[model samples]
Target chain A: MPREDVEDLELELLLEALYRHYGYDFREYARASIKRRMWRRMMEEGLATLSGLQERVLHDPACMERLLLDLSINVTSMFRDPTFYRAVRDKIVPLLRTYPFIRIWNPGCSTGEETYSLAILLREEGLESRARIYATDINAAVLQQAKEGIFPLDRMQEFTHNYLRYGGRCSFSDYYKVYGDRARFDPSLLEHAVFAQHNLVSDASFNEFNLIVCRNVMIYFDRALQDKVHDLFYRSLVRSGVLALGHKESIRFTSHADAYEELDRQEKLYRRVL
Target chain B: MVVGGSWGGLDALGQLVALLEEGCSLALAVALHRAADSPEGAMVSYLQSRCPLPVAEAEDKDAIQPGRVYLAPADYHLLVEPGRFALSIDAPVHHSRPSIDVLFETAADAYEEASGAVILTGANDDGCRGIRHMKRRGGVTMVQDPCTAVRREMPDAAIATGAVDKVLPLDQIAAVLNGLGRA
Candidate 1:
């Protein structure tokens, strides 16, 4: 067999070990991205091959945690795409207002940027008191960070720009207090927020939600995994519940495609119609 | 796959498209650096007019079809997985989210020796490492000659890597691509 084939076999075994031992199912992730992340983890650990890293991770829980962090993409920003937030305020807020209470689920909420952004949006619209936002991620480490709500102070400039572009009604700085290198966000924003670890690959939907914002998370999943999550989302959403994905993500190709109607095609906002 | 960057990329791509024959068999993926929020469907409409092949922005898990050209959508890295395309919103590489390097490197791994990468007019060095990866993986690597490029930094950087298989003008790149399709 070729060297590349041998490496592939090793990678498969590694993923299998990870799933069987750690209950993290990365087997269905897009292979190219997984392969790149695996190689990167190997380099970081100073190991020569995927099998070596796998052995370390399986035996040591710390190693597994480190590897999990590496595999889980934590790239995010506050109101990363301003237009999507604008659509939420312009199009979805009115519908959310009609309800007595709002339950919003933000799966794979890396470091709580989107969660806080939503909290701010709801507060600005005077709906925060009636909203309960559940911010979940597979990685506990990131969930901890999300609960803290502290970000690099330097990133505030970019976040402020995004906030303004998203039609923020107040000064962006009003939400957070900067100290040296870190900026601590206002705790009032998270009063109704619940931060928890929820693995999309393994966990079932716990409750029906009025809105589910899982932007950019599905892009990492393969077709089968994507279908599975879409099913979960379909079951979890209340009638006419809103689902907002990343700018590039869509429901057109999923099994639940027909169940939701496109609310904003450009912003990837969909509403449960059936 | 042909990856171009800033400067005269649009014009060069138009020229290359005009020169290629209809119904080319090779599946083409183009990564051109654009604003993350640029209007979708704009590139498809612009390029479809000049090219005979079907042109569209790549969507997640879309199967790679021959005789078609797929453009990397803005703000997402287009990765070539086995038999399908995957998009990533991971941090931008070399300040580009739809980085030419990400697409080319993934293509090199997915297609191996069967792949051909073309680096065209650009002001950045994003495609240099990707072309090198392609060449190391036994895939064909070509660069637009720096003299003919509107901005020489990109082609010059690829050439500096010493992994480029051909250095041709924009007009001739289509011919080489057609020959690769035949092969």
Candidate 2:
């Protein structure tokens, strides 16, 4: 076969093997991006080719697990995009306070950074005691990291800066214990959390949420996937609930735009409308 | 060469990778520098359609080949081993797995005298040390022109090391890489 044809075949075979063996369907993703990521995996894994990498991933459950980790993006920090978090604090928290029992979802909670950020905000607003936060991600590895709640001490100054920018009222250091090179967050901050594995792409909404924070995660999806996620978030929210997206992401083009009102246009914060 | 970037990185990298020839002689690796936990691949796919090279996510222990583009998976640090790619659970470097530093350093070690490193648009100084290492090891070092970078910090930091061989815009970086690959 021509090298050109061979490469094309390899790409298809690799995608098929991934779906058949791992049950992770990325077949519909934007191919160039998927191809880029898979090829990088090929180089990193030292397989010399995508076909070989696909073969290993097909047969080795551990390799499949690792591949899953590789495919998911996890860049997150507590109170990431401070201005966005502040918007939630100022506009959404007061509304959430009215509820007797509130359920909040931080989908794609990546290492629990945003989850804890929301927890801190809720605590400061006197709502932590009544709220239950479900922090979910498809990657088990990051979920484990989230459970540990340990961050590098060197980053505290920056995290402190972000915390303050988000209207934090206390010393950011008050949230964690400095342990050598690591800072372990106060477990009490997570008292209301139930961390779980959830594939936003493949899974349905499991429970209703008064506020859903899916920041910065949806920009990777194609229109179909984005729409599906929008529907899921809409289904998950109670009436007059809130949905927060990443700064670059918006519901403006989605079919569900009319379902939610923009609470903060700049922050991409929206409130569900009946 | 799989190119991965996030935030200001997308446009910068898009400009860089858009330069590969239809039958280029070198493979590309990318550490998208994104959240470590979101499972979605579209950016590389979009690039592949326009570039002459085939693109895909980098899997652990995958082999390198010319004329192909690779992207690092979300959570894993995409690294270059002796002649292969490997993934690690080691903590995030510069708060990112599939870090630019991790990919460049490991690629420098593996390719040693044969490697080339480019630091494009980024908000942080993640790729500077790696680019420096690549330079010390005889790899060609390049940075996107900080003046033109959407996020200047990354390219600026790389240039500050004084190890970079060229500081070109996105389009120019593509031309340089194509020239080197052809040579």
Counting clashing residue pairs in each candidate, in order, gives 0, 72
| Residue A187 in model 2: lDDT | 93
Name the runs in model 2 displaced over 4 angstroms: A1-9, B1-183
Q: What share of the true interface contacts does each candidate keep?
A: 0.68, 0.00
The residue-level lDDT of candidate 2 at A114 comes to 86
Which regions in candidate 1 have their CA more than 4 angstroms from the true location? none
Predicted structure with the largest lDDT when compared to the true one = 1
TM-score of 1: 0.95
lDDT of 1 by residue, A1-274 (tens): 9777898999999999999997899999989888878888899999999999999998899988888887665567898889899999999999999999999999999788899999999999999999999999999898888888899998998899889878899999999998899999999899999988899999999999999999988989999999999999999999999999987778988899999999999899999999
Q: Which candidate leads the pack in TM-score?
A: 1
Residue B46: error of model 2 in Å?
29
Looking at model 1 chain B, report the run of 10 residues with the lowest lDDT sum.
B1-10
Which lDDT values do the candidates have, in the order given? 0.88, 0.77
